[model samples]
Target: MALYKQLALGAGLAALLSTAAHADLSGKVIGFSQIGSESGWRAAETSVTKAEAEKRGVDLKFADAQQKQENQIKAIRGFIAQGVDAILVAPVVSTGWDEVLTEAKEASIPVVLLDRGIDASQDLYLTSVASDQVKEGRVAGEWLVKTVGDKPCNVVELQGTVGSSPAINRKQGFEEGIAGHANITLTRSQTGDFTRAKGKEVMEGFLKAEGGGKSICAVYAHNDDMAVGAIQAIKDAGLKPGSDILVVSIDAVPDIFAAMAAGEANATVELTPNMAGPAFDALDAFLNGGTVPEKFIITESKLYTPADNPQGEYEARKGLGY
Candidate 1:
């Protein structure tokens, strides 16, 4: 009887130790609302974020908004209802986020904006992890201006989604870049919805309005997918891309590197896709009773031209998903 009692006591103590070790996490849950897998980069971001959460032993609740603002709002409210410890939102648009964010703040839940920017007051959210979109546009524009110096150039612009931050900032930055360049003018500007199909449609319209490539000197796409789509349109019109219509854009996806290798694309600005590393780091710090600043974490971007795209380095990075 004495030996049996000692054995039972040892078992109870082992169970108690195990429970205490597991309780170190404080049983925190993280909720993430993604803006749908519209692009390769977006899909990569979602995948990496999920993997990061799992690796960190965070109970992550994920919601896909299917690229709709209403869906995102609904998902955020759901997270609030579930009383998640933290929430991450990749908003579809810049506006219409203040109310949902306010609710999270009221609940004392920290919200992080990922890959996109919001127009609301900064106090509504904790931090934003995104690329300097305007700077990306400026880099592309500078390359174009240098390539076509002193020549009267008519350019067609393939903008991103109508109200997204990348669309707004890229447009503004490109306009700023070409401000004093008298010889370069934007002949056509339209939204491509950040997809290849819409990019092709918009490019076809630009070709018809500008009389094909005869009058159009270049194409400036907000993303590589659009640029790739426009390349097909240029080809179908019997014009040689990179030679007849110089192509420049952002997002160094694998396809764009292929285009550059084939001489269909002239230049691109790279936007890295692996945003999960920094995001998880920030969240871990915040969860450990550490205060994080209102950070506007900007990822580094590089301009890639044919002269520098050797052995398909852009293609290799594209597999990395952002």
Candidate 2:
């Protein structure tokens, strides 16, 4: 009876604290600038963000940048003009953000970065919530190196948008991962703009240039959407994707897991869509309690393959607004 009484009291106190925290953010107006629905993971992030805000009773003003930096800048300025309490941005690109972020700071609106980080100074925003993107690429590359062993493998890379942080960092990290392995060579590389259509187009050209996909041993895409497109390109070229050319990418979206279940793809690194949860928590603390959070909050990056039960993953993530 004594233990039960203590447990009940602890539960009651925890509930009170949770309710107080929720009340601090209730009815607060927040502006979110998303980088458009470019991929499945992106759509999931937006959905989760909205659900989180609704749960917290926050009035969320959502903006889609449509993959343009100028549009994002315009939206931020609009949010500032509206005098929103806080602003969240998933920058379309890392550069070209100093001016608009400066404007937000001047207006006394706390800014939080979600998913991607900017190249500007650390003081420009309250904090950044993102995954270790370089490590994501390194994981994919390390998997390939282990899979192929000392075999001479010619790799073709499907890069993301030219100037995005994921594109730049993932490329550099993959290069570093495969540095000492002379047997693995990245022969051709090109930007797919992080789009499925462009990924297929670029891959088609790569197949033709590399002797109809005969010389290619692997294909590394910056994202799973591009990998899925590349898989189709390989199939159309009369080559098996996972068998002939090992397919590896990032952002373990549902469709990518489906591809892995069907033996179309090989591996992927997870970039979770719950970045908004941490971002909101940080905002709540900073806005209500004057508590300053860490400058960078990095989420986990786990590698997934067919052995990890791809079908189960596919089912679990199918309804996540992806």
Candidate 3:
């Protein structure tokens, strides 16, 4: 699987580099309406997006929506008024985007979605750049199922923001992954809002409700930040995180690796923060050569465990603004 990921990533990068060389975004103004820095991975994504824009000489106008759909809609309107060449949005939720997206389309402004997908029509945006969120969740679930074997296990899920695509899709995929595993039951699930503080608080409630963490066998967090927070909650309750309650999550952020190195987290699915690379590539093609890119440009999602050199992984990603 590692070799396959390397080959796939290499091919994708080669294609992107070729497209980038042929198309120039220099001096082009692009607006990025970001979902706020709610997690470490989100922060890394924002940092990488900025770096990619700088590298391509694109003038990037950024706005932080602070996890609010209204703020994002306002930012998009602001970008349209400025008549920017293109717009990028990491929507906070899937619904309520049709109206704003339609406005962008009517203005002849191509909008590309990042990370999370929206429930709006395909024609509303140029393309969506994101990982297969369902697959990430399934991978985490499969890991738990395999590790727990035939033993009966109770799992609790720490979900992302309510109504968000990641939270919904991930929850569905995890259920699918553990469908036939009769021994593993999802006992409780609740929203963590994809934040460390909220994750910790919700986990504390779960621990209290689940016999002080004794009944829970594992925790499935929608993101690494939540997993890290849950680990702290477990410690506060005088329980070993990885040993007492197996921790599995998506988004292979640096802190998650640090936890894995310390034996606090068991596994994570890698959700690369470089969604902007393909989004930028698509914009360059459309703007320069009038080429129409694929409607959905998917990125790779790989699973990581402690055996994958967690300490090295932690060091490698620690400097990427996460």
Model 3 residue pairs with clashes: none
Residue 244, candidate 3: Cα error in Å is 4.2
Q: What are the TM-scores, per candidate, against the unseen true structure?
A: 0.72, 0.75, 0.75
Count of clashes, each model:
2, 0, 0
Write one digit per residue (lDDT tens) for candidate 2, span 167-279.
Answer: 88788878887889999999999999777888999999999999999999999998888899999999999999999999999878799999999999999887777777778
**Model 3 per-residue lDDT tens digits across residues 2-116:** 1111110101222344455433888999999988876555777788788789888999999999878899999999999999999999887779998888888999999999876
Candidate 1 versus the native: TM-score? Answer: 0.72
TM-score, cand. 3:
0.75
Q: Worst 10-residue stretch by lDDT in candidate 2? A: 1-10
RMSD of each: 13.8, 10.1, 6.2
Q: Could you tell me how far off, in angstroms, the CA of residue 182 lies in candidate 2 after the best superposition?
A: 2.5
lDDT of each residue in 73-123, candidate 1, tens digit only: 999999999999889888877799989999999999988888777899998
Q: CA lDDT of each candidate?
A: 0.76, 0.83, 0.84
Runs with alpha carbons beyond 4 Å of true place in candidate 1:
1-29, 54-59, 66-85, 92-108, 118-121, 150-152, 160-168, 190-195, 201-212, 284-291, 307-322
Model 1 scores what on Cα lDDT? 0.76
lDDT of 3: 0.84
Model 3, 287: alpha-carbon shift in Å? 3.5
Return the candidate ranking by TM-score, descending.
2, 3, 1
